[model samples]
Target: MHFELGFVLLFSIATAVAIAARYFKFPYTVALVVAGLTLGVVHAFEPPHLTKDLLFAILLPGLIFEAAFHVEFRKFWKNKLAIHALAIPGVVAAVGVTALILSPVVGGLDSVRDFGFIHALVFASVIVSTDPIAVVGLFKALGAPKRLAILVEGESLLNDGTAVVLFTLIVAVAGGAHFTVGGATMDFIRVAGVGALIGGGIGFAISQVIQRVDDAMVEITLTVIAAYGSFVVAEHFHYSGVIATVVAGMLCGNWAASTSMSPSTRVAVESFWEYLAFALNSVVFLLIGLEVQLGSLLASWRPILLAYVAVVAGRAVVVYGVSALLRFTPERMPWSWSAVLTWSGLRGAISMVLVLGLPEGFAHRELLVNMTFGVVVLSIIVQGLTMAPLLRRLGVSGLKDVYQEKYELARGRVGAIHAALTALEALRRTRDIPADVVEQLERDYQQKAAAAEQELSALKQQTNRFHEEEHQEGVRRMLIVEKDALLKAYQRGVIGKEAFEHLVAELDERLAKVKDPEGHVPLEQSSPSLPDAA
Candidate 1:
């Protein structure tokens, strides 16, 4: 099919499937994967295959960008220890368990009764990463806790990198490419390191430039280029393309939050990514359902089941056994958290990519494909659909709820700030806001910004033109001290002193700015109230 026509057809199919999934109260990602399986089957019995480079090259960058760009890095960090436990070593251990137990069932590798250990390892590692976009979306719709949602989502994000690195090493070994612990380790380090530098460097540069500009359109376009270009550049240098996109995404997400971006740019970029992820994920899954060769898959069920058992048991040992040790000791992570980690693992598209991606002439490719496909189908249909119930059974509360309450509160603050900004916007049109309030707003916003870019984006052209670094920094320093004093007073239970001092400080500062642009006042002049506030 022509590229344009193909996209239209793909989109149409996605739209139809999405509607059905939504109408039936089903997970869209699950629905889409089923749809792709159907499509795979259709192609299996036919002359042509639906899986192609276009499905990835055209759709994937935007999807990756959307997920990475919008995900809050701060929250992801909050749960990194737990996320690593479940995604990284967890994947490797699962692979080992599957290979050891399922060997007999898979049959005859190198004229023997067992599937080769290495091959099974490849399949397990490849399938270990989670794609929870559809399930997470449902959680959001169901009003799940934000922390659960982020834990699941953050793990998914990191595992893509972990899995890719693992997959690459496995593929190299399978293809009889040079295999060395030292070489492989070196290769991984270079790929991950170079990819991160390229992606993060570009993201940081983009953030810097974006802060100076007010145009939403330009910022969105830059993000698009960052997503695709970062991948291509990294891949060209033989680095991890997925990691490049991820790093770029993390950096961009950080900037999106800070005052560095215009409100319109933030909204535009967010809207663009959300839609893009949906479109790509939808089409990818639908094609999965559309093109399945069910009978061929059925033929491979024996090995698939065996492999599934191995993987599950392995995951259990690592999750419950090893994790139990961590719980009783220094880490002190709740046992309930580990239980949620096991159930929360929901694998999707990337696993399928590797399942189908084995080179055509490899000796054991068919067995690998069949077993991989079977395990994936089970995970998606069986484990996936039942994850939430399993979590509740294991006593894991919805982290999404925690996140939602936090989000609502944060968003409320955002809303109020937006109101202030709107008021500022209106004041721009009409000289209603006092001149002092306007200047205070600009410099005050700058220092609190998470990064430099956010604060700079809030500046008016006039502020830039008449910019005085000396005056701006001094004003910023004074305001911060006064703000600190107010908080300290509140903490000390001296409400009257707090109010009186804060009010005097605010009035005097505003008056001082009106009096002299270059003069400064230090925060230390105020009597301290409480240590925490200071």
Candidate 2:
């Protein structure tokens, strides 16, 4: 297919799949992959291959930035120990364990007995990065605790950089580069550290620029530069581009978007990125399906299955190990989260792209590709299909009831009606409409607004869940106000340093409990005492 025409076709198919997925209540990304696979099998016009160049140069930075942009650094930092442990060392351990387990099993197979530890290690590294795109949305939809979602998302965001850096190192070692434990450790630190520095510098610069501009388009363009520019510069210096992009995105989203950009501009920028993410995700998932050769995959089903099992086992061990260690910390989570975390490790585009980028003459290249592709497909289809049920089984899914939806609709209607009334009043003042007509319209809207508000109130009365939600919302707002006041008081020297820190810490704990109500004691039940400044 012509390059231009291929994209047109892909987007059209994605549009159709999106509509169908929504109608049938299916996971849209999964459906796209399935659509791509079906179309490929039926010899639907050949789509452009999902090349490493295409992914690394274009799709990756945008996707990473978009995801990272929305991640509040405060939330990410709260579980820093857990997120870092799982993403950095946890990923490395998982890779090593996967290799150790897979090498002997695959060596025992008569078909490819030569698949050694290094090849297994390489494959493990490729697949260790979790793509929780499918599951994160489900978490929100199912009302899972926000902290749990943060852990999953924050880990994924950081691990992508770790996995990519590890993959590069392993591939280098495989290609005859000298390897040493100390050297590799230092190299990883330097690459990641320098990338972070580069990203922070670029992000800070862009944020400065954004604060000086009020135009939405200008601020949005600056963010785009921060995202791609950081990646390109870091990669050009042989550093970790993924890490650079992620850091840049986090700063821009949490710092620039919040403090610098006006509300309207922020909304515009956010909307643009959201649509871009959806578009990029659509193409990537669809291409993942088209890339797989069913016949080849079927022939390699034995290794694929074994590899998949190894990956899962490896992840499970790491998750449980991490969970055990976390039990002593403030960040400790329920043991059941280990199972969810392990199962959520579904490999996606990064694995596929890295494997494909391997040199043509690399040992067992085709087999490695086949194994990576097969495992990616299996993980997405199998795990994605079952995540909701898994959440239900674990009792982690919160408020998966109809009342939540009805409450949301009623609340939205009330807000919309109020906005409409505001607009009507503005028109009544400016337009030459008759007084009686204006009065009639005003009465009509008032009645509609009252009806919507009453409906919302009744729904809140109908369920404690609604009441709890409203209470939590109100509490969160008040806590934020208190925190803001505390910050200003400390800054103005109205409060002592120790007292400010103590009060702020208390407020943060309360906020955390409010956000993850299922995991912590309710604020109502906790000691609510505050100490005075000395």
For candidate 2, the 10 contiguous residues with the lowest summed lDDT are: 520-529
* Model 1 per-residue lDDT tens digits across residues 116-175: 677766776767667776567655664445666776677777677777788878887877
RMSD of each: 13.0, 4.9
TM-score of 1: 0.72
Local distance difference test, each candidate: 0.66, 0.89
lDDT of 2 by residue, 323-364 (tens): 999877667888778888988888899999999989989998
For candidate 1, the 10 contiguous residues with the lowest summed lDDT are: 515-524
Model 2 error, position 202 (Å): 0.8
